[model samples]
Target: MKSVTVKNLIDLFKLEVLIGNEHIGRVITRSRAHRPGLEFVGYFDFFPMERVQVLGKKEINYLHKLTEEERNHHIGNIVKYHPPCFVVAANQEGLKYLMKYCEQEGIPLLRTAEPTTEFINKLDMYLIQALAPEMAIHGVCVNVSGIGILLRGKSGIGKSETAHTLIHRGHRLVADDVVTLKKLGPNTLLGTHNESTREFLALRSIGLVNVVRLYGRKAFQEQSRIVLDIELTHWKDQALNNDLELEPKFSDYLDVRIPYIEIQLQPGRDVASLIEAAANNWYLKQQGYSAAEEFMKRLQNE
Candidate 1:
């Protein structure tokens, strides 16, 4: 279900616990929060119980105008729905009645000093990132010329060695051995190093090495947006029937298509330089310039 507990939010936001300390372990499945304004007016038909209920200044002011008996009745009904928790934003007053109701019902009541809008904005961002879909790929990711390039191939095909060479050339290594990919938006895929392998690269003869320590901090990046995927293959696998021109190919990750390319690994080929050139070519293509297309046009003119 990929749920985070109310305790996580409490710790992350440093929220003050007003009541129901024992119930902080309650699960919060939804990333969005709800304001209980309409629910306070005897309208509970469409209320969302899965979301955290927020009591802002506007809702608290309305509650202040209610009679003791009426306020308790409405608050009791709202608590009966059993929302994950209730957050009082801006630390508004007039929350004694609501706090008492939550305490009685064993519902966690949290108080934050931030305004309603700002608090919600931060909470939403945190929840979205915490709940984003993620996957791991067997490859090495590097940032070259501001472009994230992923190198994939069978083990022992020099993916790590290529990344090591690139790092020496001033490019930054994002991940090696395993790259974790998270889908943040519809078309955005972020790549990061797996925690166990962060800042470490494995080479066939050299064994494990710390890339950051060897090349300094500039040789490693915590994460990068994967814009291109390159698959390294044996030289014998190169197909003679394939087109030699720069044709755009795509690889799908979390339903987002990324530009894909394949490079043949052979003796004496400067794979690192080729990778750098690929990154530069990708940058040029993004700027609406294609050297291959321009060359074709020139040939036609000649």
Candidate 2:
């Protein structure tokens, strides 16, 4: 449901607005662009009206080959469909008639200096980032050994405290209290700090601290790809007696399942070290080395 206006595109691309100043608010619901070559020849059966129509050199040349009446009729039908906007790439001239139609129909007409393919690629990338699905979660996200590790637990479970310690140990903190996660692709989730608390971290003893200033800019990251999830829980005597070796677990967020682990927080246990080790272990697992699996294989062979 995410959408961006033609004005947003203009601002992002710095395009020249040839017409339809009043209709720059047209919504662009799709990230893809259409050439409309067939539609230009008076075929509109499968025209994608929601996409931004991109008029390249070939389409413009084809329009020039037609007679005045033929050109207007075909172009008129295209405008009648109410496309989001028309972007004339390569800064191609001889678009006066098309601009006139856009002005008459109140459809925004934009011009870009870049070639058609390059402009389309840039616009698609921008739209994809702008329209990605996002959600905020109550947790701490940090870059541990180049792996984005998310710490989740109840209030006062030391999520922020562990993040603080990790930052001191040279790991970058992405978000402390609220982690905003965006799904960029089918299996990719990007994590970033909430704008309100981007460079700040909250702690019980010291009210609020600026991590960037305290630990330098290297101690913070604007965003990172989430790869692991670590949940903290209070220690129980019975739980400690369970199997020491466990299979890998996964947690789902935005339909992407991330490698997951649970650590027990106890009075004397070093939570920061445990989390750091967990991150390193996760990295090793990604590299195809699993200590637990190897040990299990050894037991089977014996």
Candidate 3:
């Protein structure tokens, strides 16, 4: 997940800074004077400390009625407890005090002319994301004409080798060895490899080589929308999760579901050919034509 700071919040909506410059917290407040999580919309708790704080119109209207002392008490209590970075609201209609409070307390204050609904919508979406879990696996990801394909397997499983072969066959590479996945939204996943891992493919006997230098730039993609996942594992004593046969299932990490496929590896199994066929098969299933399903239906009819 992207750590949302006050600056990030301001940048997100193109809002002007109004007050509170020194405040920082994980929760983005929709109202300055109200307690955290009191906002009806876009209120989230249990977020990282670097998360952005936001304030909306309803809370601002509520703050307008309080006396100076009461407002001060409320803001003071919030600063003492939560210490939010930004107090975002819709417009500056009745929120002149927000600037004053930020100046006095060194907390950042931001205002967006955009309506409360739109502001909340954007912030909520930007804030809600699942980061890729830290893992050490040798793999390669490719965005072949906008299709996100991840190749996974054990060491010496020909993962990187197959990726190189696929690239030779006119496919675009996204990442190699380690893939960082981020759930941008429901059913939308973005995959990126670490800077250190970019374009570095490991060959069984040759060691690590710079693919970008050799493949001329088309061998690396910083990011791509993940559409499919393929895992290569040695033929071993393990069971495949049957749920993958129903709805494309993935291991849930940080509240995100990634579509995954597990392929067992053995000698003489052409990994590159399998990958290509997997992509084509995935595409067919995505378009509502499943050969397996068709065969099953035919058998039942007969």
- Model 2: per-residue Cα lDDT over 264-290, one tens digit each: 898888888988888888778779998
lDDT of 3 by residue, 195-214 (tens): 78777777778888877788
Assess candidate 1 and give its lDDT: 0.90
Steric clashes per prediction? 0, 0, 20
Query: RMSDs, each prediction?
Result: 3.1, 2.7, 6.6
* C-alpha lDDT of all candidate models, in order: 0.90, 0.90, 0.65
Comparing 2 and 3 by lDDT, which wins? 2
Best by TM-score: 2
Between prediction 1 and prediction 3, which has the larger TM-score?
1
Scored by Cα lDDT, where does model 3 land? 0.65
| Candidate 1: clashing pairs of residues | none
Better of 1 and 2 by TM-score: 2
